[model samples]
Target: MTPETGRQLRFAVLDMQVIDPPTGGSRQRLLGLFGQLGSATAYVGTWDWRGQSERKQMLTATLQEHLVPLTPAHFDAVEREAAHINGGTVIDVTFHRLAALSPGYVAAARAAAEVADVVIFSHPWCWPLVAPVMRPDQLLVYDAHNVEGLLRLGLLDDGARGTALARDVVRLELELCRAADLILACSAEDVDGFIRLYGIDGTKIRIVPNGAFAAALSPAAAKEREEVRGRLGLDASPLAFFIGSDYGPNGDAARFIADRLAPALPDTRFVIAGAVGQSLAGRALAANVRVTGAIEESAKADWLRAADIAVNPMFAGSGTNVKMLDYFAAGLPVVTTPTGARGLGGAAGAMRIADAPSFGEAVRSLVADAPLRLDMAAAARRAVERQFGWDRISPATGRLLASRAARRGPAPFFSVVVPTYCRPAHLDRLVAHLEQQRCRDFEVLVVDQSPEAWCGAAWKHGFPLRYVRTDTRSAVIARNLGADLAAGAVIAFTDDDCEPHPGWLEAARPAFDEPGVVGLEGLILSDKVGDPEWRSVTNDGFEGIGFMTANLFVQANAFHRLGGFDGDFEEPHFREDTDLGWRLQAIGKVNFSREAWVFHPPHRRTEERESLQARSRFFEKDALLLRKHPGRYPALFRAEAQWTHNPYFREHLLRGAARYGVTVPDELLDLIQ
Candidate 1:
């Protein structure tokens, strides 16, 4: 089903707090995304007085909010668990306690997940609680605000306790990544971190930057800005301001402003707002620095307008700074460190980037020169509109929702069938690779055709491995036998030599959502093929409907309808995959996915001579294929020719090479012609 043919998707977001006032960047991002979806609901855990009031006023045209009251007992339980986990060291236990203590939150989230086509969890902590309640068909997305493990590790003072907690956090994060169908990272760096730290496939992750809504800067807000400034009783004195919720990084930034920047810029009055303001109030301030303890959401715009310059002296933080985006929305010139301006990328050019020593000077310079400040303010506003505004960011979320909504029916569970003959070592590697797959629903069926049952060693790798021995020395017969014994809705095929990517199953699972799609061919990347032409062929084949069993997924019923692979081709062990592809095409539509990739190395030492001899027998198999399906071979050959010249094929080859960290010669393209 196309997105236009389907009903509007109902989005449910599971978060730790009510998003009416949006406490931090994560909540703000969720609110912005939810607003764009139109039919959206939020299942939030409200633990405090602030959240309770926000929950009461949460009903709106675009969003329906469900609040789960988290009592003091919940906090106590979480603290106890954290203390036990960390050997009695009191660490940040909010996330750790969330899944264990908040039964009401979990129950509410589960209810939301049942009806919604798409369910988004705000953090990894919510995954364990919500995952069990989610239906198999629901598209689970993780809106990762930061690499929480790394963030927590950075905040810890006790090394041993920190390491222990970090390890636990990393494990939980990995589990969450494995559970999620798609992970929405706050920045590109977080995406890279997931891949680098946990070996998660990049295809499953996407960058959805944190941004302020464009409505914050709309014409109507200008009147409110002036009223707020007047209400605050701000004079002509050039006011510099900073605002943040009570996070470790925010506290450090506040301290930096109080101790370093405030003392240097004595002539300018600096206002510190939000939750962090209370912490800074006790600190010795330069008479010029004023702490407005926890400014209300209504007064935030006025505070921003009252300030001549906005400052973010953040030395530490993992994700994009939402406060910087807010400052830009308020049309205030920003002076932030490179660290503070991390995910802004090109937008950072609009702000004054400075280090610790030079931060105060940059702010003072902006304050002293009205012309420079005006130029920067204009640039900042333009940057926000161009990049850091919800108008630009929310559309990506909309597109993702629409695409997922287009898929019909419950998600099919896969039974991955690997037909191995005599190559025990290859089977071992294949099992190891399968164990790393992010999608955990699938089970492995290793159809071993070896004389001896050598694939038994793979059982220790775990994840529901079924090893069956077939006396027949045929890949075709092995696959059919495996399919007969398989219990999943879909049967995915891969040779023993092929190493499937971590996200291969997750990426391929979506294709079967379309009832018409009977088959899916995943990209086969090989560095072993010495010929540039063959490599081009590998890339080209990725787009073609013609399937290769090296990496293929087909509906179980469709496989049965096709009568499985022809047992006649068992001797040669060639063209059986192609024959099945033709049979599947005759029955229903076949889809291709480049993201579901597998690396197929060239023939090993023992098989090289056999493979060489098999090349000579290809014509016999080709003849049989042509005779079986009369007049189709010519069209198939023509389609192959078209695939060879496809622009995407060349791009795919280059991208594949880059992914493997291999450099292909430029002359290879010249040879393609």
Candidate 2:
């Protein structure tokens, strides 16, 4: 089907990057798109704007721009200093997820969307910030500068930032495509990537390729160009220029120009321009090469005016190269790799496209034939002016404002309550496992009941967290406290020592959404460490049996209605979860979501010692549980021991005494009988 075209519509471009100064290529793409798009306002999301004004001047003066501010909760100067002292960061959350933690940005995006016909997310990262609150009337456009997931993989040395960042980025990009009403791809390659990588509907995507977005140059005359060259102390040698920002691909290209291309031809003068020069720090370059760390626009124009030829040896990166467009716009005869020519291969007739091994030969041919260089330069200028110009791109994007597709569903928020008492190592392990979860809609509440408070591990995990310290050390009390402070519709319960599965919440969400499912429980796979520490809770998967709060979720309304786990079931924290589960089951349905599981490793790091004293404490708690539910409580244990707490409690106590070859102490004898 033909794309609906020529229908005029207003656009609200939502970008998370600080576009005012614009460091990267994505910002340049956004700026170029926003400048000419009729009746458009770019809402740039900035969470940390401490010294942006002093950094660089902005060009948003020519267009409408509203800054959507969202400062993190207590990421002060002190916290930043603490992070440095801590060796590494406690939390490794992405900026987009961090923005989701801010309700202010969500509200701002929603309010801003009301006035615009279409909301264009400049990159995949911006989608999570606005998708949850997107209005039904507004169209969601994902402007795919790159198939970010694939691009991130090719960036840097495989695992420079580790697998977590790359994994999260890919997951985020997948969700962005599913949620977008329309996706604006930079190349036909990027379009196929979305379809092949995620298998999204190819029809919803449109190619609005990158264009010549550089500023108009001043003083292109021979004397002006020669004077600029003379200022740089460059001789009358033929200049071969390559310009780029400090991205990994650009860095590779810069190094290519300095190492590979220049050493081969000492007679030809080479200049590596822009922030890309910083990558060559401390490295010796070829004598023919001059590295300009970074330059202003006018300085760039001077190099373009004076340069004999342009070259791009880039091997990695996604999307069309904006630097290639800049080279074409400046009327320079260019030589580049096929990887460098990705979407711009249509301009091959006007430029030289070669593979990596043959890139030197291509550049040499252009540098040697002066007449051929003049012809290629004229052709490159004509290509940008006609086919690759912003003027052509604007009309091709009109269909994005006209199209509409079904929006992806928002993930449900859950308050994951962890009743922790000491074993900071266990808490750290749990934090790592929680961060690995595919879902990002949950917040963790670590109700720490350690004798010494853990100096607050709040905001130290990928998820939003609250670390609370209490003088009273009780599992029942911690659960109650977490429930009281919970902002989510569902309050999920898991122990501090347990490692929840990554899909635990994603699997649990559906069960809670069902009608009358006031509370639910999940499978607990007990993992024994060396000696058996406690009851290996590998629940036999029996129906109506494994309602242990080791992995549980209860509807907030029903939880508060039942007064949240009876506090009387205090210390050796035995039957509180069972008591609450039974109580909730009486009021409404308590279910089991089999796939929503957690690993219940033994309390190896904990001080839950096995002794007569500990056994006596357990017996006392068992007596309390019997008193609370005389009929139901006994049914759970042996039929004979179930009648009363004395028989059941006495057996466990005597059995514990037998292990040490001693009878119950005289002082405690009467209590057990």
Candidate 3:
């Protein structure tokens, strides 16, 4: 820990490229991470001596820099190798060369890793240089901007060499994954890929998403927008703008826009900015198209302000687009492909999702309608404020660092709490699953709210099982009653309908070791497809923010501190867990564990009348919840509305209802609306 800020640990970042200008996604993430950790040093490699002095001056004030100058001969050799690889269909040639570090660069990275408490490798290319020097005690973190192997494979054609290259990349990536203590993925999709492809421990991975440095970009006033537009040249026409570095994906998008889209929409002026502008240089562009090569950081906001709509016609990309975030921050309505929208999580709602064939029309539609553009721009800006704001995202990263520092001795004993209401079969199955848990030092407490004692037979289980009966019919009251009786230091909660995975307790218990973490929620996977409830519950985007009672864990002391769940939410089971989560979050951090798995099988409604009544009760409870949290209601309502109307969501709802023999009346649909 540093002397000034005792909580934040000192971090040293090793990167093959100097992140002075912070143009690309990798550099942007480096700047964001270092900005969050005040006391940090960055060891960057310089390509040549031409701009060595200028590069040093361009380093961000937040980071202490060490630039390792590379000889021209060494740079040429690496460039030659990259050029050879570029002859094949490898997408990110520049990124691949970073892995080929010289001996001098390796020594500098090793020396820096020795003094730092945590050493972060910006990309897998920097991994080998710092991995050899990493001490066992020092935490090694890999900030995976994208799944490099998958990106390469996507760009490659089907052939023997492609297969071999793909195989080698996967093998290398797996080794890098195993070497790091923690891996920060840019998106949940990357996390899923790692788990599926490499079988890496999910607990060691976190979603430290790419976000816009909007705060760093000065807000463009109305006068500034007008002035910038005047300086660029008089333009009353709607401008479709895109800005990106000279990466393959960006170059592809720029070519597509200049060759394909711009000709069709001749009325709209297409402005291509950044290094990608060079790719469109000699092409016969439409009269409306303009290529502005590499605008400075100071002029970025002005250019964005002058544009009417931001367009990302990306067909191939692995991670979240930082340019989309920048567009939102600039209050420009965006139109992008689903590929470009990947890893943006829920914030993708703000942008118009389209495919390659329909992308031009999407941009044209936004340009034609001023009202729609304004609404989208407003929503986009709001989404950035609520979700992508650095204030909200940075602390989550800091918590990861703080957790590493707070990890202690042997795991604490756990008290697993299950609140059931007249569900004997579900409770019995749940107990059987608990019996199969890998960790044996846990007690199961069942608080039954049934009129009669239905789960009394669970006492015969192999583990310590405590069954209690209560006359009340409230899930909240039952949870509070069970927490009071719990003897362990940690209190874990799961619905009676949920079946804990064999390693569930073993995976969730380690989170408590992290400092300031009061509550933990495990990944709740649906046992069956087309389960309507599973759509929102299984969304990885809601990892840190949302809470689900079906799979929740909280510290015993924190449970008592917050007075358990609110009694007002007892009758209506809806939002009761959410209300408690809000309170818990206020006091301390509540983490999400992708490893702590629980399978929630959809429960079929035995009686149609009861099902309608339950749905009505859910709506009633939701209304009360909205009244309680007035400020949060609008965003919650918008999110739910968006989910409800989504084609995939609707298909699930219809299919699940039919499969489960559940009937949805018109009244319920109207009520939901």
Q: Pick the candidate with the highest TM-score.
A: 3
Please, what are the lDDT tens digits per residue for candidate 3 over residues 161-237?
Answer: 55566666776678889988777777656776777778776556666667777676533677887898998894788
Pairs of colliding residues, candidate 2: none
Tens digits of per-residue lDDT for model 1, 1-673: 2355456677777766667667677678767766665555555555443234324335456567667776556666666756654644232334544445556656776777788878887777667666667778778888888887677677663667556666777777888888887777766567667777877755456566788876765322556656766788866677888999877789899899888877887888888898887667656788888888787765777787677888899988787889888888878878888788766643532577778987877787778878767666776776667556776566546655555555454443998999888888888788889989999888777888788988365547647676777555667757866775555678899989888999999999888888799889889887645543233125444365457888888887667544467543444456678888888887688888889999887544345443433344343344445545655654554555533534444444443333222334444446444
| Candidate number with the higher TM-score (1 or 2) | 1
Question: Mind giving the per-residue lDDT tens digits that candidate 2 earns over 404-496?
Answer: 322224423798999888778888888889999987888887888788776548445677786766655667756766665556778899988
Model 1 TM-score? 0.57
Root-mean-square deviation of candidate 2:
27.2
lDDT of candidates 1 onward, in order: 0.69, 0.67, 0.69
Model 1: lowest-lDDT 10 consecutive positions: 655-664
Q: lDDT for model 1, please.
A: 0.69
Question: What shift in Å separates residue 33 of candidate 3 from its native position after superposition?
Answer: 1.9
